[model samples]
Target: MTKEITVTINGEEHTHEVESRTLLVHFIREIAELTGTHIGCDTSSCGACTILIDGKSAKSCTILAVQVNGKNVTTVEGLATTEGVHPIQEGFKENHGLHCGFCTSGMMMRCVELLENNPNPTEEEIRWGISGNLCRCTGYNNIVKAVQYAGAKLRGDELPSTEPVFVE
Candidate 1:
């Protein structure tokens, strides 16, 4: 039987009837029409479907829509503003954090949650936090740079203001 689910997405409350078996990713992408969350692997190996659930990073593909009822979800689409891009998004862009772009959303979302939880994470903490969000492209160097850039930006410090700063 289809079940009703109420969730807040990108700051908007949405109510819908979805199959209990519907994956959160499918609900976000197919029903809500938010395609920013991608489905890369079926066995939960890839973190491409990562999203901020209740201010924490969670894999949408592995989560059921009903599981997030009344919860807040933040997707890549919600990470920008009229002022400019969210620091994390800008960091990923400026640092070449993504190449194929398939894993960019997951990385950004992961870093978003990480920073919110710990704004001043060390390089080791950042590395540990993003360890689950794998990016085959760039060998994770750019990804690390992006996360650092975002951390610095969130702390009100000036970012390198350029693409791909030297190894720090």
Candidate 2:
């Protein structure tokens, strides 16, 4: 069976007729044409399909489009505004939090929620927070630093140096 659902994504309302089993991630990518949300694992184990639903982080692959009917969704594409890039995005770029970039979007979405909840998360806390999202590259150390950088920026603290640290 198909249902007509309207979901506001990035402040834009999208109405579409979708199948009962259509995943929210598919709706975002296929219907909304937001390709930033990747489909790494359909089972939701990879957290690659993560997105913000009503300002909360959720695995898009695990949610049905109908489940988010009349809800607001935020994909990675919505993170940046005309003013500048979101701190999380800048953190990733400055800290080299991503390598292949397959999981960058989802990682950023998760970080958005993490920073919202705890703007000054410790390194350990950031590690624990992003445990759900898996990134094959970057070895997670830089990812943690990226979160730290974003947290500092969000909290209006002194911004960390964006210089890339070289390792022997």
Candidate 3:
């Protein structure tokens, strides 16, 4: 038997008929067609499948689709706008925060939710906050920088000069 549930994804309303075991990640990627949220380490060890569910960060793969009814979900794709990239996205880009880019989406979403609560986070706090998310590239130095960049942005100050320049 399939149960129907209503979820608002990226500001769009979607109704899906899913089984009790269906995961939010599968629904977001397959049903919603928003593939920015990747599934990795399905055991919930790696935070590769994080998304904002009702303004809080959650592991998408760990959540069943049928569990979210009348909830607002925001993935990495929803973070941007017609005006350009979201501040967190811009921060990651400016700080050279992404390489291979597998864990980036989850990191960005975490940062978004982090700033929503604590706009100014210390380096240690930021590091502790994202300890769940793993990145096999860039050694997370840039990721920390990226979160700091976003923190600065949320504080309504200049974003410490993040210019994207690719060298040949």
Candidate 2: pairs in clash: none
- Report the C-alpha lDDT of model 1 over 1-168, residue by residue, as the tens digit: 799999999999889999999999999999889999999985577889999888889899889999999999999999999998999988888888888999899888888989988888887898898888778888887777788788888898877555545676
lDDT of 3: 0.90
Off by over 4 Å in 3: 161-168
lDDT of 2 by residue, 1-168 (tens): 999999999999999999999999999999999999999988988899999999999999999999999999999999999999999998999999999999999999999999999889888889889999999988998898889898898888998887777899
Comparing 1 with 2 on TM-score, the higher-scoring candidate is 2
* 40 Cα displacement, candidate 1 (Å): 0.9
Segments of candidate 2 deviating more than 4 angstroms: 164-168
Q: CA lDDT of each candidate? A: 0.87, 0.94, 0.90
| Candidate 3 global TM-score | 0.94
lDDT of 3 at 53: 96
Q: Which of candidates 1 and 3 is the stronger one according to TM-score?
A: 3
* RMSD, every candidate, angstroms: 2.1, 1.1, 3.1
Residue 140 of candidate 3: its Cα lDDT? Answer: 80
